[model samples]
Target: MQPLSHLESFVRSAESGSFSAAARQLGLTPAAVSKNVARLEAGLGLRLFQRSTRKLVLTEGGERLLQQISGALGTLSDAVAGAAEAGRQPAGTLKVSMGQAFGREYMVPLLSDFLARYPAILPDWHFDNRQVDLIGEGFDAAIGGGIQLTPGLVARELGRVHVVAVAAPGYFGGRAAPTHPSALAGFDSIVRRSSPTGRLRTWTLRGPAGEEAAVEGRPRMILSDPEAMCRAAAMGLGIALVPMPFALPALQAGALARVLPGWYADAGPLSLYYPSKKLLPAKTRVFVDFVVDQFHARGFAERMSGAGEPVA
Candidate 1:
């Protein structure tokens, strides 16, 4: 019997008219989707999609196969979805991905609560800085900022991520804290290198009253990890722009202090991304709702977005 995954890929590609579109819906890469379709065609000894740079057109055999299997595929999907919804327990291995620092700070603590709430759901969470392919790598969901939306995927805004300037308490022992973004020029700055691009990131600060300024300073150190940037700042190496989540604990412990109060760089919304909205498994559905609820309940959205009274 032909593999069901290939059939699903074939039908989705035919309907969507491109592998990229099918990839978005199925959570696989275009290459992977094409490979699946090609494999299906090889097994059946037929050219399914007319290879082209512009658009994928189905062959006569492909059309016949699609017409014959489309109904069966729908029936299979509905049956599986019905079974998932009717299951008494949301018992399954829930694979998830998130940023290492963000996960450590926010998601790790919440796992206990989530597991407690859904005893049958097993959590397999991977923490990394790189963007993950949710469908290709088989992740049920991902939580982070700036996730690229592909076909069939949905994003829920958890909160805004803000970057703030931080320095060690000792670094400012005799010097006054920077009152404005321009004053940061006097300090030695530890900047982050973009992991994917290998380029240094610049810090642009937005004031409470809607003022904007980009910090220009002597680069004392360059690091790639946000946690390390915060640590370097705490150790008096240099003032660093860091995500608030990575700096929160040290700030609370007096290891690091905010340099410019009420000024932060908005890094856009932190989102929880997952696959298509149709007939989602109970485990994934509950987890998405639970995480969003936690963010709202704890005021993380306000704190992270630099909107609340203050972080004192």
Candidate 2:
């Protein structure tokens, strides 16, 4: 591999648009910047910049190289910062913005465990379902899972959240079992105001033809949150398509029954997102690490249900 020193200097020069400016910004002499770029071009066997008396322009080759170089340098920078921050065990307040149901169901238990482990750290938690502006709201991190991701934030995948279509035993007491997702149209359903999936978002099932199956249902009870959906299904009001974490407790208590376990949709991953910055303070890093380590991708559903799942 070519030396990163030369590649970093090359990227800095391209971004700054001049050797002198890049040198001044990086605390190196103009000649050093020129030499680094020359070394980089030699390593790649390509000319990067067209240098004139008054202006510097990147060659086509330089533009392509800059794309890869910038990302590499940025990753290296973050790695360095992470290493430096790890030495310190941070103490202070960490503000978390999360969905109301998720906050109550999972984060509360997770936070209790964290607080017990690190008594010095006190986190202020806020629960809301709408999109939140992390910088505007003064939030250090957000625990949100869905396909929609906020631009300019770094999102780390926690795990896939499984969704199950459920109803009370009495609701389907006399009716024949629904064989397909479309069959749910014949039954009442609880729907939230919004869905993670759009029109195409439906339960994916393997059909008789060995092809994938999808079905759409009309909402009998349009609810605002997962709790309402779960309750409606438990009360034998309708079939509710809800996340596994939300229905797990009731399923174990025998209050709710899984309608079609083999035909439920697999929702996407739950993620912890934060800002990608030069210095993620010690408290934020520790919280991120602690929560990620705690989740480890598998135990969240089991933990939420109060079931003992094998450790991931």
State residue 71's C-alpha deviation in candidate 2, in Å.
Answer: 12
Candidate 2 residue lDDT tens string, 5-88: 787678767766788777754568889989998987888899999999886899998888887667768678668757875756
Q: Write the per-residue lDDT of candidate 1 for residues 26-124, one digit (tens) a residue.
A: 778899999999899999999988979988999999899999997788678757876867957777888899988788888999978998899999998
| C-alpha lDDT of residue 223 in model 2 | 71
Model 1 TM-score on a 0 to 1 scale: 0.81
The true-versus-predicted C-alpha distance at residue 144 of model 1, in Å, is 1.2
TM-score, per-candidate, Cα-based: 0.81, 0.64
Clashing pairs in 1: none
For model 2 the TM-score comes to 0.64
For all predictions, the C-alpha RMSD in Å is 5.3, 9.5
For TM-score, the strongest prediction is 1
Error of 1 at 41 (Å): 5.4
